[model samples]
Every structure is written in C-alpha cells, then in structure tokens.
Target: MAISKHIIITSLFISLLLLHPLVQAIDQEMTSNNRGGSSFAPKMNCGVACEARCRLSSRQNLCKRACGTCCSRCNCVPPGTSGNQELCPCYYTMTTHGGRRKCP
Candidate 1:
C-alpha cells in the first residue's frame, strides 16, 4: 500500500514536471505578445461604437446587437454604417453559426 502511494505521488510529480515547460512556453509567448502595450486589452466602449455602427440601419436593435458582438470580440468597429470592413479584419471575418456574415 505504501509503495503504491509512493508510486502515485512519483507519477504525479513527473507529469507536472513534463507539463511545466509547456506552461512556461505558453506564458512566455503571451508575455512577449503583450510587450508592446498592456497585458490586458483596453475594453471597447461597445455601446457607443455599436450605436454609431447601427445608426443608419433599418433594423436598429438587431444591428446594435450584431455590432456590439463584433465590437466586443474585435475591440473595433469600422467608422461608418456600411462597407468599410477593411479597417477591422477580425470584425470583417466573423461569421454566424450558419456561415452567414456576423458583423454588421
């Protein structure tokens, strides 16, 4: 019983040791990615951005919801109510579950 318990602890320790380098690599990559600025992204004012994005929509509420979702994820919105997707690639590439374009 003691030997089995020792073996279990030894196995656990080895597993953690193997995982340590992988965890460190991920941490280093994230740290380097953020070295240019804050580690946490500044939150977007989705309400105002979305409001502007949706201002000219015929379906205002639906437009706001879609614009808000894209703004939240991309932290950006193209400057107008229409067709300037080149400004935000993340927002431009997003799609709905059914493969329809997601961002307004």
Candidate 2:
C-alpha cells in the first residue's frame, strides 16, 4: 500500500510538472485575449444594446432585465432578439442561479 501511494504521489507530481508549461501558455493566451478582463471589449451602451436585444421578446420586461445584467457584466449583447451568442463568449456563458442560460 505504501509503495502504491508513493507511486501515485510521484506520478501526480510528474504530471503537474509536465503540464505546467501548457497551463502557462493557456493563461497567457487568455490574458492577451481579454487583457485580464478589463476594458477589452469596446465601450457599449448597455441600454441601447439590451433594447435591441430584447425588442422582439414577448416578455419584454423580463428579457430586458436579464439582458441588462448580461450586458453590464459581459459588455456585450448579441444582435437581434435571438441567437448570435457567438459574438460574445462572455454573454454566451452567462447563466442564472438555476444554471439556465440567462441572456435572451
């Protein structure tokens, strides 16, 4: 049992060491991609963006409420009242407390 435990620890250490460079590269790429998540996207008017996004929703108020929250956080709103989440990865990934997609 001790030998197996030792082997496991050694393997885990080796794995993390080998993966360190890969982790650093990923971190660097993401940092560059969003500049540490500060002002990376162009300044946008959340009111206008959410208005456009929620314009066609049957439940306009709820749509705008959720869209407003998403816009403030992601600094983006998908064009139109429907799909196009690809334009904003952050918005695409936003979720509610219930784990459902939040943006309209």
Candidate 3:
C-alpha cells in the first residue's frame, strides 16, 4: 500500500508538469485571437487619411510620413487636420524618440 501511494503521487506530479507548457500555449493562442488575429485586422486607407490629416501642415512631406507610419501601426487616423486625438486612443498615445507626440 505504501509503495502504491508513492507511485500514484509521482504519476500525478509528472502529469501536471508535462501539462504546464500545453496549458501556457493554449492561453497564448487565446490572447492572440482576442487581440484580433493579425490576418483579420481591418485594413485602412492610410494614404487618403494621411493626406487629409497632413494637408495643413507647413512641413507637408514630414507630416505625411509621420501620419502614414502611425496609421499603419494603429490601423487608424483621428479625423481632422489637428486636435481631435480623442477619437483614436492608439494613434493618440504614440510618441517620438524625443518624447513628443508622434502621430499627426
């Protein structure tokens, strides 16, 4: 009886150890799916939106470049030429290396 009890406990402990990685992989997959599977994220027209947002900037080329980068990453562009950042949280929170707002 003592030897059988030891075997049962050892088997259960080994099984749990083996199952840990499989459980972690399933959790990671669920997390990725919940974030909108990359292949299924809605595509946005970055060109038109960037153009519209950067239209009034004195540095048109720079504005377009920055806006395009932000839109591509966030898949969004806040409407209007300026000051409506509340519309897109992802776009609004991006920052440059200098710690200034990066999104146009």
Candidate 4:
C-alpha cells in the first residue's frame, strides 16, 4: 500500500514537471501575440544614430558606413531612394562574420 502511494505521488510530480514547460510556452505565445511579436527592434523615430546602432556589429556597421561613404563620394544613391535618404540595402545586417554577405 505504501509503495502504491509513493508511485502515485511520484507520477503526479512527474506530470506536473512535464506540463510546466508547456504552460509557460503557452503564456509566452499569448504575450508575444498581444505585443508586437518581439521588442528587440530599434525604434524608427530615433533617425540616423539609431539606424547605425541597429547595425551594431563591426561587419554590419561596415556595410552601413560603406553605404554612407559611397553615397557621399559618388553623389549617387543606390537603387532605392526616398528623395535624399539612403535605404537599407541588406534584409538584415549580419553580425556573424563568417556567413554569406548580407542582403540589401
């Protein structure tokens, strides 16, 4: 009888442990859906400085700096332009150095 009680208690504890992660996952999903997915992105209102910050890593910032330099030196903008503003060429600037070149 004592063994059976111990087994039942252990089973309940194990089930709760397994379900805890699932419950947390559901809560996180709900919160993300309520918010705008992720808060990691930089606020657009900050303008140029913030734009440079978003491309934080050395390589990524390199591309950005290149764009700015290229624009000034050539006095010609890339394909996309909103009047005088230079557009982000890469899809997402890459911080990882060894990966393929970033998308524009």
Tell me which residue pairs clash in candidate 4: 89-104, 90-103, 90-104
lDDT of 2: 0.89
Computed on alpha carbons, the lDDT of every model, listed in order, comes to: 0.90, 0.89, 0.92, 0.50
Ten residues in sequence with the least summed lDDT for candidate 4: 75-84
lDDT of 2 by residue, 52-104 (tens): 88888899999999999988888888887799998999999988889999888
Q: For model 1, state the Cα shift of residue 79 in Å.
A: 0.8
Badly placed stretches (over 4 Å) of model 4 are 37-104
TM-score of each: 0.64, 0.61, 0.64, 0.35
By lDDT, the best candidate is: 3
Question: What order do you get sorting by lDDT, best first?
Answer: 3, 1, 2, 4
- Please provide, for model 4 over 18-60, each residue's C-alpha lDDT reduced to its tens digit, 9 standing for 90 to 100: 9999999999988886685235443333235434443544565
Write the residue-wise lDDT of candidate 3 on 8-103 in tens digits: 999999999999999999999988986974667778999999999999999999999999999999888998899899798889899999999998
Candidate 3: regions farther than 4 A off: 1-39
* TM-score of structure candidate 1: 0.64
Worst 10-residue lDDT window for candidate 1 reads: 35-44
Clashes of 3: 0
**Model 3: pairs clashing at backbone N, Cα or C within 3 Å:** none
| TM-score sort, best first | 1, 3, 2, 4
Model 3 Cα displacement at 91 (Å)?
Answer: 0.8
